[model samples]
Target chain A: MMELDENKKFSKILVPIDGSESSFKAAQFAIAIAHKFKSQIICLHVIVSPQPHEYANLSGLVTPKQIDKIIFDVKKETNLWFDRIKEHQNSENNKIEILTDVILTGLTPYGEITQYAENKKINLIVIGTKGKTKLKKLLLGSTASGVITYAHCPVLVVK
Target chain B: MKEFKKILTPIDGSEHSLSAASYALELAIKFLSEIHIISILPSKIKYGDSSGYFGMVPPKYFDKYKKEAEMWFEQLKNTIKSNEFNLDKIITEVITSPLSVSSAILEYGESKNVDLIVMGTKGKTGLRRLLIGSTAQEIVTYAHCPVMVVR
Candidate 1:
């Protein structure tokens, strides 16, 4: 941790991206905060369940073509997101570090995000909420809410 | 109603609380207000009962704690002075009773009719804050005046 002067503002912010409109809004918010504090932004994206499974008991199948397609799609989308962030970099002189662009083949998004944040020692987490319907959110718990509950640092949930 | 001209900041010697103190000083400098720094002392220090010839600490231990708190306040004052911030007053209150920290701060802020309350966030999250929330959070929710949280 940097030795912070009591009057100094925030110096680092972590933003999670999922390529949604709300996520883009959150990115914008993070940019504003970073500009205010002269802080850097760390952009993160998680790739969950990259492979398909077809099994009733012990049978499973995944074609090479399908795996290649998933990997390519993940890389393409991630690059597009990075390009969007680069657009904002033209105005600020702060150092922006692309900490991690991960593709985790797992089912637990919340747990993975929490673990990554803990490992990184992020100052703050900025996420976007889909504002899902109450019933939908209850059944398929929103990732943003789950992250807020589990995050160790302050979370800003952009609507 | 008259605008608030005085503010009271309670310090616990924690970095979070010191952040609040810095924020309070900034606001005082902006609003041209006075600030009072207060520190409370817990009623008892529970040491083990006498088993051998050596015994637990005497009641005077509480006095020692009060003296230490005053010294901290003085050091804090000197630091602010070095920074060239003029503080109208610095107060150190040693409350030995079992009083709620949030309530004490709120009561003092109200009594002084402060326009704003500034505090620092302890930065607790997840299951750790399931039952016990941060004092800054409690103050923000219950304070009569606008509360600024400095993280």
Candidate 2:
């Protein structure tokens, strides 16, 4: 392994994305931090597939063709989201490099985030506290908390 | 004007804690700030119960902790001195609490009027954290200054 130089600052910053307003705000923060530290921003968006018994937006009688169409639509939506981010970056004159990943995972968003951060050797993680689901918080059982508790790197939970 | 002037960094001497300290030292170089390295002594037993001895730790354990704390601070001080981060001032301290260590850390930061806090997210065991609660989250929740958490 090559030795790490002492002067490096935030070599890799990870942001778990959900394409929500809060998550976008977190990306904004990540951008600013990256500019200061000369780091790369890793934007991660986890996609959750519905279970067999779980409710699908379409009717239960949906065909395989319909499922394929849904997948295509989802990928397109995610691409558009990143395109908007590129537009924002250009408008803000921010030169920070951003890498976006749309992942398919189980329902545990926080667990996936923590694992990804560690596996990627992420220096820092910036994330929004509340997710798409507005479920009641279990005291400190928020997604941000879960990532903060278990993450190998430091986690910034934007409120 | 540079926003961060005095930075407070709390550590548990874990691998990640040292990394966070180095990051804080880098910030200190940026702003010509003072870095305060502190280690909080946790209360081993669970708190908030009337049945248990409240606000008091066993004297024998306290004495043992006091010596260990001094050694930890000395080690931290030596590390800071050896580091070539262009940092002019570094102060190391150890805070002891029988309960509510997180709140105590925050209160200490407030008292010192530190502009920012840098800490590691991983150090204490998950089970221990579950019993006493997450300190980093508590500090983030209560701190008036901006907190930069390092892994």
lDDT minimum window of 10 residues, candidate 1 chain A: A131-140
Q: Name the runs in model 1 displaced over 4 angstroms.
A: A1-12, A36-38, A50-68, A93-95, A98-100, A131-141, B1-151
Interface Cα RMSD for candidate 2?
5.8
- Tens digit per residue, CA lDDT, model 2, B13-90: 665666677677776765668889887775666664344466466778778777776675565555544455553488
Error of 2 at B97 (Å): 4.8
| Model 2: pairs clashing at backbone N, Cα or C within 3 Å | A153-B151, A154-B151
True contacts kept of each: 0.00, 0.20
True lDDT of residue B49, candidate 1: 23
C-alpha DockQ for predicted model 2: 0.27
Cα lDDT listed for each candidate: 0.60, 0.70
Local accuracy of candidate 2 as per-residue lDDT tens digits, A1-159: 011346456789998877777677677767766766778888888766556455454566545565566567777888877877656666655577889887766568888888888889888898766666656543233677777767776666565
